[model samples]
Target: MHIKPIKTEADHRAALARIDELWEAEPNTPEGDELEVLVTLVDAYEETHFPIDVPDPIEAIRFRMEQQGLEDKDLVAFLGQRSRVTEVMNRKRGLSITMIRKLHEGLKIPLECLVKEYQLVK
Candidate 1:
């Protein structure tokens, strides 16, 4: 169990390779523990060096809609009337606090994903 902190791309790659080797290691054993720690180290390194941007608010809504097999009309309850739904989905309108809360609660979309800053057509 010679685990090392992943500080560079080389270290990250090595950790990933080790994780692959230990993928089937029995849990709670030495190899399994090493795999778990290496995964955490690699994840932290990637998060900082390869940070992922948050999805646009409208995109998040559309993704959630797709996941739930929903269409524009389905969002009318959370977004208001049919026209409002179209406007929001079309990026013609910004999502208000009320709409954010409703979407988060009703569609099970993460609040962090829904609250991301997004441009709206003037």
Candidate 2:
């Protein structure tokens, strides 16, 4: 096995190809051991080089609303009255714990994404 740290795009590509070849390698075998090491190296390289930023909290809420075919009225059940929903959506009001929990549970939005503090326009 000739494994190395994936330092460059070329190295990442090579590691990916090797991983594909070793996809079916049996565990505890030589090829399997190499596969595990290569996978770790590839993951590390991707985490550093291709990191994905979390979506904006309001954007995430809007996206989930669209995906679920939800309307303002639907949000009233989660957030409060229609006006409050509008306030929250428009960044005029902050999300309460109850609203956050509802969004997290009913919309399947990640709690971390929902809990992030966003700027409220004055």
Candidate 3:
């Protein structure tokens, strides 16, 4: 099991091929141990090379709402009146801490996504 820091496109491709080969390795065995280490290295490399930022809070909320077949009115239970939901969704207002907590609890939106700073407009 030879693994190294994935520093370029070639290294990344090689690591991915190795990962595919190790995909079905059984746990607690020599091959499995190598697979685990390879996976960790791959994750670290991807985190550095292919970082993904969290989406804006309102976008996250709207996405979850769409996924759950919810609408603006449905958010009233968590975000208060329909107008407030509209304002929040339109990015005219920031999420209050209480609102953030409620949205997190009610919608299962991650706090990390919720807490990201975003412009009120655009």
Candidate 4:
């Protein structure tokens, strides 16, 4: 098993192919070790070259709502009222600390995502 730093897209592709071939390798063996190293290297390269930015706070909330089949009314428990939910979702108002905490706990949205700064609709 041979491996090198994945620099170019071609190198990335080659690493992926190798990983596929070694995917069935049993653990505690040379092939398994090579597969683990290749997977880690591929992940690192992708993160550096194609970093994904965190979702906007409002968008994150909307995404979670969709995932959980929730509506604006459901958000009242986490937010306050229907109007407040609309305002927050529309970016007409910002999330307060209390709202953030509730959303994090109720919706299982990460605090890091909730605290991210986003431009209110202007």
lDDT winner between candidates 2 and 4: 4
lDDT of each: 0.90, 0.90, 0.89, 0.94
lDDT of 1 by residue, 1-122 (tens): 89878888899889888999999999899998998898889889999999998798888888888888999999989999999999998899999999999999999888898888888887
Best by TM-score: 1
**Candidate 4 — which pairs collide?**
none
Q: lDDT order of candidates, best first?
A: 4, 2, 1, 3
Summarize candidate 3's per-residue lDDT along 1-45 as a digit string, tens digits.
666777888988887888798889999988899889878888888
| Segments in model 2 whose C-alpha atoms lie over 4 Å from true places | 20-37
The clash tally of candidate 3 reads 0
- What TM-score would each prediction reach against the true structure? 0.95, 0.76, 0.89, 0.93
**Per-residue lDDT for 85 in model 1?**
94
**On a 0 to 1 TM-score scale, where does candidate 3 land against the true structure?**
0.89
Total backbone collisions for each predicted model: 0, 0, 0, 0
Error of 2 at 18 (Å): 3.2
Candidate 1 — what's its lDDT?
Answer: 0.90
In order of TM-score, best first, we have 1, 4, 3, 2
| Root-mean-square deviation (CA) per prediction | 1.0, 2.5, 1.6, 1.2
Candidate 4 versus the native: TM-score?
0.93
For residue 60, what is the lDDT in candidate 1?
89
Better of 2 and 3 by lDDT: 2
